[model samples]
Target: MFSRLIRAALLAATPLSVSAAPVPANDAQRGLAALQAMDARVAAVGERLAVRGAPLCGDRQMRSGLLVHGLAQYAPAARADAAALFGLGDAPAVLAVVPGSGADRAGLQAGDAIIAVEGDDVATATAPQGAARFDAVQRVEDRIEAGLADGALSLTIRRDGRERAVRVTGDEGCASRFQMIPATRLNASAGPYVSVTSAIVEFVASDDELALVLAHELSHNILKHGARLDRQGTSRGLLRAFGKNPGRIRATEDEADRMALYLMARAGYDIAVAPAFWDRFGRRTGFGMFSDRTHSGRRDRMALAVREIALIRAQQARGEAPTPDFAGR
Candidate 1:
């Protein structure tokens, strides 16, 4: 007993491992994390948006397996080697498989590389030199979308050097497309497509809040905010180059928020959490600044969200279709 006690004491006296966990991330790790998070969020938000936004936007044709690729526009390093990108995710990988999605049900996983769609090779049938990382991948997606235009799609995904054919039935929904980009700025943009920064995706507290952001961005597309700004002669390059024209930007923001209230409501997302998100998000370290040159004040944003919600609620109570007031834009 004495000998055991002495050994235990000495063992306890030894220094613990100097771990680097819970420390600052190097640039590479930070970049990888941002990209990975973006892909994961892409899978998640894409699934959610397809389900909710499709019904609201009136796309309702049928479902594409929630299969995400690693070589999308934002993360191109995956094209370097099949394995390297696969390590980050699957090479040209299946980044995420949404729960209960067609992909999920079809037995696809995160580390599967879609080698071929139908009979054609996914990335030129083999990797090419000096090609844009996402070129062939884009072609594969395009082919799948087109093939699905009239019917189903069949894919052969290679995992661990083994290939298995998976058939996907594509359902058409909203016209808006979704993309994930690795950016630190809390910025998301919408056109025919809605692209959200990985930062905003990781920052939001819940999917509901994320939907709020996406809904607002989608509103920009729904109202053609960028095109309208152009029509109004608001210089886009100058506005972005130097934070000029607060009034025009503020008007667009107000319009987006107003339309978002109705859009998100129709999509069955909780607009109530929106006020709370705007309340906390704007006060963050890199956010919530009182910028007169770009966005409106926090007070104005908060008030606008609340006002829109009230108006929507009143409209709902009156048994009237809550039409978005995008008049005179």
Candidate 2:
């Protein structure tokens, strides 16, 4: 759990893709708009999984299906343009509201500026100089998480040049946050949060494929793989690819693969998409120096997914829930 937490923290602080490369003012505006569109797509799918996967998670939290961005999340060069483009202030503002979510039902809309959470002032939130801009927005997210824990939330928001109080009573969801890291890398990670890169978001052919990736990461969190590895004396550093660590890491990876299918099926995603997607990802992008050692090979992963899909099909044929067997897992 400690390792997972650290990984997520560091990843969130990493510079976003828009900030990774320099562009002209107009180009920056387009980039920010493109990033928000991607964020909205990811938020929609994530909201669905949060509600549907609640049964698989032992821990639960209120899910509002709200995604926010602030002026601070942009690079210094892009901040001014971003502020004008999005009408953002120092406070966190809504970037997207998934349709049918509690936030949407409560009349929350994109561009609403968050002022306070349950009467606690957050309008002056600021990130430290020379630090990741997300740090400031993350503080607001932390407060919102705490407020939602009480089963409901009251927010003061600025919209249409006016301020109003909004009450949000969200649905209970799996205790995990899904985030999109605006980077070009085709990678994803799981811990307290499940995050995917913007590149992977665009790489996926369909939401079904995207669900396969997110579900795999979310499965790692649900299964407590990080804590389990930490207990087994596994190293999270370079040494992780050496000694018994490679096998240990591969084992968790394999387990996450199996669990991911069931997670998707439970969320009403077609399990049939798993095999092909894994095979493509493995053959095309799964080979890295350490990745080769810490993960199952393409053929092995595909075979496992095929078998799991069969089991899921059998259960569905019998009118039973498609639950993954956790016998030795």
* Per-candidate TM-score against the hidden true structure: 0.72, 0.89
- Which lDDT tens digits does candidate 2 get at residues 65-172? 776667666666666776676666778787677878888888887767899988998887743244345767777888888888877889999987999999988888
Which candidate should be chosen as best, given lDDT against the real structure? Answer: 2
lDDT per model, in order? 0.58, 0.75
**lDDT of model 2 at position 142:** 83
What is the overall TM-score of model 1 with all chains considered together?
Answer: 0.72
Query: Candidate 2 at residue 253, lDDT?
Result: 87
| Clash counts for the predictions, in order | 8, 0
Q: Output the lDDT of residue 154, model 1.
A: 79
Clashing pairs in 2: none
Query: Which residue pairs does candidate 1 place in steric collision?
Result: 59-173, 62-171, 62-172, 63-171, 86-90, 86-91, 90-93, 282-288
Off by over 4 Å in 2: 1-25, 127-131, 289-292, 327-329
Model 1 worst lDDT run, 10 consecutive residues: 6-15
Alpha-carbon lDDT of model 2:
0.75
